[model samples]
Target: MEDKELKDKLLLSKLKAEDKLKDRILHQINAEQALIPKKRKSKRASKENYFSIFGIMYAVILSLGVYFYSQTEKNPLESNTFVFSVIFVAGSFSIYWFLMVYMNYKKVKQ
Candidate 1:
């Protein structure tokens, strides 16, 4: 190949590289905008999902209560630990379910 032609090709490649570098630098300068999370426009459906979760939680708790009750009957003097555990387990489930419903109502009113 001719020396002049080789020099022109090298110059073209250098220009392309410089253009790419400029774009990357500009992108980095405005990168903070993209880094910020986009706000959620609406979350009505998010309420329904929480309710479904609460429903499942209650169902599971009820099943657990039935199991524990039967077991305690089989052996009336199991352990203090078992009785305390059953009480707390049911209470936590109720609290969480109520919280989800309250949150759901508050969000829906918005």
Candidate 2:
């Protein structure tokens, strides 16, 4: 009976030591993680940035179209086709811009 009791006590002590070792390992891992700096996630350009850039481009293209139209009017030798194509492209861009704005608005509303 005494031998059995001694064996049980030895087993309990070993289990307690193992538990302590596990706890120390976990604590060390947590401390190392805390000391390490987390990397920042990169973000793509936002809708506002896209809008601002495209808005500037749209304005420039429209202005150029108007300038060319005026020039074509003054110089009858120049064809109006180039001005018409510019206007068409500008109109397409404006449509796409408005659609994107509407989709963003809807997403925000949700």
Candidate 3:
């Protein structure tokens, strides 16, 4: 019948209009995303860089402690105390560094 044919044409037109709207919305979204800028390095990466720098400084201090301990030929008691203090400080720094690294790893994993 003509009535049924007219209904089918109307339905087809409605579907086509919806498809065009969807495509336009998608294109706008893509254009907006393209205009946005992305960061090159993350916060985690900057923290890792800071850790590395501190690690190098720790190594230097430990090496200096060793050098001083070896150079001190006289005053055995003074040398022993100095070495003990250096070792204690180095140990504490090492433990703290390991804990920070573990915490960062856990955060990243989650």
Candidate 4:
């Protein structure tokens, strides 16, 4: 009876180890799936969602402003246009972040 009990405990432990290993393999597979970038889901190639004309204009203006600001006539970042441009970029990024969160929330609900 004692030997049978010991054998039962050993088998149970082996099953437990196998289950844990299986879970780890599944997790690894999921990680690999995530690493494989889904081309259809990527926004970078989407012309409709990618840089609009206004977005390009704003980006160009921001880039030029920042570049000019870095060149010393006076403190470049101190310029009102630079400050406003930075604010605009920050505001746009914040709005985009909120939109992403809201969209994700809606998706989760659905």
Best candidate, TM-score? 4
Q: Tell me the tens digit of each residue's lDDT in model 2 across 1-110.
A: 69999998888777435668888999999997864533111112235646775787677766776776687655422556665766676777777777766665565445
Residue 14's lDDT within candidate 2 is 71
For 1-110, candidate 1 gives per-residue lDDT tens digits of 99999998898777345678988988997795654432232244555666676677667656766676787755423656556765776677667767776776676565
The weakest ten consecutive residues by lDDT in model 2 span 37-46
Better of 1 and 4 by TM-score: 4
* Model 2 backbone overlap count: 0
lDDT (Cα atoms) of all candidates against the true structure: 0.65, 0.64, 0.67, 0.65
Worst 10 residues of 4 by lDDT: 39-48
State every prediction's TM-score relative to the real structure. Answer: 0.35, 0.36, 0.38, 0.39
lDDT of 3 by residue, 1-110 (tens): 69999999888777435678988999999987754432222355647756885787577666766767578855444676666766776777677776776766675455
- Clash count for each candidate, listed in order shown: 0, 0, 0, 0
Which candidate, 2 or 4, would have the higher lDDT against the true structure? 4
- TM-score order of candidates, best first? 4, 3, 2, 1
lDDT for model 4, please.
0.65
Off by over 4 Å in 3: 1-78
Cα-based lDDT at residue 23, candidate 3: 86
Q: Per-residue lDDT of 36-104 in model 4, one digit per residue for the tens?
A: 565334434343343553476577666767686667566657788767876777677657756765665
